[model samples]
Target chain A: MISYMLCLVLFSVGLYCILRKRNVIKIIIGIGIMEYAANLFFVLLGYRTHGRSPIYAIDQEIKSMVDPLTQSVVLTGIVLGLSVTLLLVAIAIRIYERYGTFDITKITKLKG
Target chain B: MEISFIAIPLASAFVVAMIANLDERIQDCIACLAALATLTLSLFAITVLSGAGSSGAIVYKVGGWVPPFGVSIVIDGLAAFMLVTVNLIALAALFYSTGYMKKYTDKWKFYALFLLLLAGINGVLVSGDVFNLYIFMEIAAIAAYALVAFGTTAEELEASFKYAVMGTVASCFIFLGIAFLYGYSSTLNMADMASVLASKGPSGALLLASVLFLMGFGLKAALAPFHAWLAYAHSSAPAPVSAMLSGVVIKVLGMYAIARIFFNVFGITPVISFMILTLAVLSMIVGSMLAFVQSDIKRMLAYSTVSQIGYVALGLGVGTPLAIFGALFHLFNHSLFKSLLFLNSGSIERVAGTRDMGKIAGILDKAPLTAYTGLVGALSICGVPPLGGFWSKFIIILACIQAGRPILALTAVVVSILTLAYYFKSYTPVLFGNVTTSKQIKAKSLFTMNAPMVALTVLVALAAFILIPVVGNVFMDGAVASLVRGISYTDVVFEALK
Candidate 1:
């Protein structure tokens, strides 16, 4: 429960960064932090107290095993998160080159 | 056959990347051929699906592992419908890009990202597991971010950055929701999860998961409150990308995901249905009202996307068989006309050298093909009678009335009129007024560009003419039955697996 609360706090902090920050790079960082928080929560979801790695052999007795599914999912999520982060950084760099500033407010060419 | 939907595009994307060093002519030929193949395969799938019984959903287990253990591809009425929409729009967008993308260098990279995005959308539509769905969503989302920043201009980059940030945050919420669901159900397969959820009544954790999903997918769908990034990212992208984004991406990524999760995995309740309807109403009102204020052609179309999606959401929210049919019908029709309209905008931008409506005038006398197509598209979108939009909107509102929600039905009527009003306002200045400006207007390209607009314009007209019989059996019945079946989905899956 405490761990879940910690995850929530981390998520809120990331949200604040995304909502309040004006710098494009900083907003990207906020997104990274949020994804990391979710990934952490996924890992925690599969954790067990003193649980062994989930593997099986013909002779081994089956006991408490940490869920293997969340680990695999988190691994995929991490990879995807990395790609998204890279794309964000690349876009931010290009934005800086074009607008001459990382500030989002200065880059207001598109509007309704 | 199932894998081909994904494999074909994935291979094409790789080939495009490899052949980026080649001459432009070869690149254009490869890109057009690949896109045509995808479109043909999707049409074939639709035929196969039309013959399938509601009880006959096909599941292709990856690596020959049974579902609930390994990943599987489940193709059903709904999946087939969405696949057809995505692929058709992709084909049209590719054709448009062939002409529109000449201005930008490195045509190969553009097609590569486009095909990659197509593969991702198909993968998401067919995946049976929750986690794999997220994976495919990421694939699509990531590709979309790159495509939005393809121009790498200040405005494009800024919009792309903002879109990426908002989209990533939404993805985080989705992942968190999935984690909660997995923790509770101990299964990742949607069918198996539904069974587990049924066995265990709705819990606080499940409620939390639902809320998380609503927020996350809501952001993706661009519901009224979460719609800030859509107008920016959509209008800022190049025309074909904008077409694909507004045409089918949001629908597949947002609405399809929401429908699959809500109606299949988690049974719909009145409260949840009401919440969806409220959001739908808000989107309809806000999107149309806001669109009335936009001068940029594509930007107006972007807001119209929001309004059209509202009709879909409202239909889904009603949760009646007829209502679901209305929603799905509107979804397909919107994809057709919206893509056509976006391509039309691209043509206008190409010919007149501007997207600003206030500055540019008299596109009709200048470019006859684009003007006519734009007129047809506008009529279809505004729910004008004898056009595709009218029938779908009529059915949806009728369904609302039949479902005893007259107020929502009334709101639907008013909003659609608002839709007509805004579309006409945008259309008149560009397509109808006198040609005073002496900008040299020429066709963008013959095979790659003009063909798509012509074909899609024909389809928009054909959809309107064929509304009665074609839509009756193919879309309306299928979508309605899918929604009507509801939680019985769990029973069917468990029985099939057993």
Candidate 2:
């Protein structure tokens, strides 16, 4: 329960970075942090107190195993997160080229 | 054949990307043909479902895996209905982009992203598992963010950055929600999870998961309070991308997910309905008012999308069969007319080289096709009496009244009127005035651009009659029945598997 609370606290910190940061790169990092928090929570959900690795071998006997499904889901989530991060970074680079600033406030060409 | 809905688009996107060395025109044909193929399959799905009756669905288990353990592609009334809407708009956007994309240097890249976007949308609509749904949602969302910044202009990049950041946060919320649900039910299959959730009754974890999903999907759909990113994103992207984004992305990823999960998976509680109703009311009033104040043409349309989504949410919030039917019908109509309107704006921007409604005066003579078709789109979106939009808003309000929510019904009616006011005020300067300014409209309205507008105009006019029993049987009723079935959806999928 405490670990779950820790995961959510990390998630909240990322949300704060997204909401409060002015630099585009910092916000992208925040996005990465948020994704990892969710990934960590998924890991926690599948964990057993003394769980063995979820692997199969004809020669070995297993008493208990962690949920393999959440591990696989986390792996997929990480790849997706990488794609998002790379795209965000690429867009940030292009933004710097156009506006010549990292500050989001100065990037006001799209305002109402 | 169920696999064809996804495979064809995926193959076409791959083909488009691989042939980057070839002439750009080839990729355009590839994208259109891919869209046409899925549309044919979508039509086929409808025919098959209409005959199979209520419990009938097309269930395709990936790699020959069974329902609960593998990624199952299930096409039911709801999925089929959404498929048709998505593919239809996708086809139009592909055709429009052929002409519209010439202004940009690289055409092949645009077709690649566009087809991938279609593939992602189709994947979302067809997948029966929450995990698959998340994967596809990311695919579509990522494609959309990249396409929005395709111009590489400062404004487009700014909008894309903001949209991407907010979208990432929303997705994380959704991902965490999925984790919570997984922990509670120990299954990612939506139908199976629905059964588990039903058997478990209400719990604290379920409550948290639902609230997290509400925030995630609501932000994607751009509900009133979470709608800061939409105006800039819509106004900044190229027009066809704008059309696709506004037309179906929000509906499939946001509204459709909300309806499917809340109604089917989680089973809507009084608390859930109350929360949805609150959001609906706020979205309707705020979106329309904000839209009315916007000077940019696409931004105005974007805000109106927020308002229109409110109507759909209101119907879902009411949670009666009639209201869900109204909501689905309105969703279909909005996709058509909104895409038409966005396409029209693209054409206007292409010819006049500007999107400022105040400046592009009296374009009827300069671009007759855009002016006339845009008028149809404008009227349709405004919910004019004979057009499709009117029927949807009327039904939603009627449902609210029947559900004994007079205040909500009144809100829907007033918001509909507000919709008319904004469309009227904005289009007056755009369509009615004479071209007296020095801006020489340099571009000619081409056949590629005008064709989609005309096609969509005819569709917009005819979309109103779709709710009639004869047509609705094939198109709308299946969608409503599937949702009405709710938790029994698991039985339907299991039955189809056998």
Share of true Cα-Cα contacts across chains kept by each model: 0.96, 0.96
**Predicted complexes: DockQ each:** 0.88, 0.92
Off by over 4 Å in 1: B52-54, B437-447, B494-498
RMSD to the hidden true structure, all candidates: 1.7, 1.2
lDDT digits (tens) for residues B310-343 of candidate 2? 9999999998999999999999999999999999
Runs of candidate 2 with Cα error greater than 4 angstroms are A56-60, B52-54
Candidate 2 per-residue C-alpha lDDT over A1-112 given as tens digits, one digit per residue, 9 for 90 to 100: 9999999899999999988999988888889889999999999899998999978899999888899999999999999999999999999999999999999888898766
Q: How would you encode candidate 1's per-residue C-alpha lDDT over A16-72 as one tens digit per residue? A: 899999987778788888888899999999999889997889999867889888898
Task: Write one digit per residue (lDDT tens) for candidate 1, span B135-174.
Answer: 9899999999999989888778878887988898889989
Best by DockQ: 2
